[model samples]
Target: MTQQDAQTKPLTVDAVMARSGVQFGTSGARGEVVAMTDQVCHAYTTGFLQHLAGLGEFSPGMRVAVAGDLRPSTPRIMAACAQAVRDLGGEPVFCGFVPTPALALYAFGQGIPSLMVTGSHIPADRNGIKFYRPKGEVLKEDEAGMRGQVIATDPALFDDAGMLKAEAPLPEVTEVARSYIQRYVDHFGPQALRGLTIGVYQHSAVGRDVLVEVVEALGGKAVALGRATQFIPVDTEAIRPEDVELAKGWAAEFGFDAIISTDGDSDRPLLADHTGEWLRGDILGVLCARALRAHAVVTPVSSNTVLERSGAFAETDRTRIGSPFVIAAMNAHLAKGEQPVVGYEANGGFLLGTKLGSLEPLPTRDAVLPVLTVIVASRPGKIRDLIEELPPRVTYSDRIQNFATEKSEAIFAKLLEGDKDAQIVRLNEHFGAIAGAVTQLDLTDGIRMTTEQGVIIHLRRSGNAPELRCYSESDTVEQAKAINEQALAIVRDKLA
Candidate 1:
């Protein structure tokens, strides 16, 4: 059966919720396709626009650009959202089948608010909606307000027929993509990457060819490999061992400097060196910051502290682990003329310095910019050599036992109440005594604690998935592994 037919048939709210797993995350709204039907998507999009209009957030004739990734279900979701925008009395400009960064660029170019329908590297069955104000991402409070309106409003109000009647034509605007490509070229300058051969694994990414174009535009040969019809959801944060072998073989055969790829949507990047070792995302972010010699660098708390140790950034700022939080922090710094040259995530996406004058594009996390920095900075040696020259530190991340939605929320709420006496006491008693005192504790994203031995432990329920992620960092690989094991054991005891 077609998606539209399935969505039109009656389904209970409980069933929908069970299927969708709709819950709040560090980003925006996310859920499975079964739960996020055309009806639900239409309602949420309509409500968000209505909320913005009611608050005088957008002008009556203001344009609202929309885009999506290459998800099989994205086309229908995009159509529903377009209709919803029209129903709310805003012009809908459709940039069909583009990356998240592309949509952000389009919105910035049009000087209008926008939205992107994607789930990043999540499973194929999952999807999400990210809203952008003219300035940048929508705030958490604004997201909550929009969700409230969606829940309170009636879905029938945004039916297909009513939406069609309200439809208004939006001018075609593909030049925004070209403009963004040129922005990268201009920032790095022509021939910045002279004499570099880069291999791009185009495994069904929506922006696969775009990545190649950007690389070649900057004076590099891009060897495309592993082109696939089915979407390969690459978690750039965590590259599988098999993919690492494949990348190594390709790099050796092609005699390339580095291998570059992105997740399904091309928002996050994955890179492999000539030696065939997959570079971790956090390492890439730090390396890029070092290359640019950023005056002030902003990153998520989940990132490695290597940036501080590398002496590349004069000041380092940490935010909760999401692009929106990082972007917000970057915007705040720019307002004070701090001129943050770089902002990035542990997931291999880097934001360049803000562009000024004549409706400049806001610097959001992007995969292309970071990949380019890595390529330009590397010497004749493999990418791994450049990484080894840095300070010695190892970071490890793995999810603890998975939990149901209600259970995960309950655990986080308890942690936020500052009942540390009971919680900390029980944790110490369960995990045995350590050598150093609990030097610092933070609850920005989750419960993160550090020890004097240079071991760091961060525990938080995954905002996007059902798992609880526990990250550890130490001076050595073995030490990091031990800390990760101990942290997971402690979590298992507590949750049990």
Candidate 2:
């Protein structure tokens, strides 16, 4: 090696993240797989532990739990986390490929911190590590804390390309897959799903096997279908057209009581009715909370407004987009002594704020709970009936990827300038008019403009990936879909 090369200093965690295109989103740190080199992951983990240590979360010989999804990049990223744990004087407990909530439940039970290597439902090329506190998910405050920490690494451990020179095998770890299964079995009992023919559409999700196990354990005849070996990025928030058609065809041909599935990591749920039409996620959250008898429910502004209009809960709370924001709001409700506090995202990932019976406390998003709860709540009816019972508000969402964040923010800023009348005129000029004039504008997470005719148009940047999302709502489903489709195309062309 050259003398100057030997003297080259290693980059700090923040610097590495900045250069590698990895950054903290609403939930976790995510980036392309190439940017998530072993050294970069190690620096990220080291910074996380340092942040936790600042909060008195770790010490010498302290135990830290680790888990991963089935993504190809997961094992490598986890190995990096294990190495970091070793260097920080902490013991790493390896919990092989499991749902994010399953690992979280085990870690929170042990009163130790844990890290999950999964990108949730994003594309396979992108992945992230979700950090957990002893109590629950790390709040937004914790993300800020990690960003300020200084992380240093040994120069000898990495090559000139910044990748780990040698790979370290995972440590001896416990398998908590059964424990997570037992969690649902104990709470709902063996016959909660009796006489129900649940179709498990097993994609390449990490939780596919677990989904089948839990359903069968509950006396539900789980018919597995479409199990895939390669990872398929199934966005529960934005169900693909083909998936919708397939679920509908299967439900009609197979006579399924319901079709249950989840995203890539099985955090956010995707459920379809007996006739094969998928239900919206916010509706799932409402039904699940109702089943649990939760007096208060927390969700984000992007969720359906039917949560409030339906008058289902004693208290309803809204936050900015993301689980951290929803969980934080749920925490506030807990301080008020609200029992059975539960929260969920627009993607239908349920969070239990407090322990409910045999179910341990898991404040992280879980695809399984909402699936079971919504199915059980449908007692003598169908998933479609439970949804049809709700108010007639329909929501449609779509995104334009690779849309620069600066471009998205700039467009919103420009449209939101001047008077409201001027804004509507500009919008109508660009993409025609919404149903009616703008009556209200919500700037909670993004800019949600509600028209006098009860149409809602929400435009926001995706928290996880590089994209701009548009969510629209109307009394009719077709209009809702059309409104969003039109808006997104306009944004795409304008930005392009």
Model 1 C-alpha lDDT per residue in residues 1-496, reported as the tens digit of each score: 2235335654433333344566556666678776676666766676567667667777667789888888887877777787667666678888767667878877876668888888877777888878877756777767666755633334444444323223334446444467667877888877876788888888878888888888888887888988888767677765655687889899778887888899877888888887666777888998887776667788999888887888777778899998778877777777778754568888888776565333244576688877777777876566787788779988877764345656767765655455766656444444434425555667788877776676788877778867677778888878776777777776666653
Deviation from native of the Cα of residue 115 in model 2, angstroms: 0.9
lDDT of 2 by residue, 305-408 (tens): 99898887899999999999999899899999998899988899999998898887788899999989889888888777788788899888888888877888
Deviation from native of the Cα of residue 142 in model 1, angstroms? 2.2
Compare the candidates by TM-score and give the number of the best one.
2
Q: What is the lDDT of candidate 1?
A: 0.72
Which prediction has the highest lDDT against the true structure? Answer: 2
Candidate 2 weakest lDDT stretch, 10 residues = 1-10
| Per-model CA lDDT versus the true structure | 0.72, 0.86
RMSD of each: 4.8, 2.2
Model 2 lDDT, full chain set: 0.86
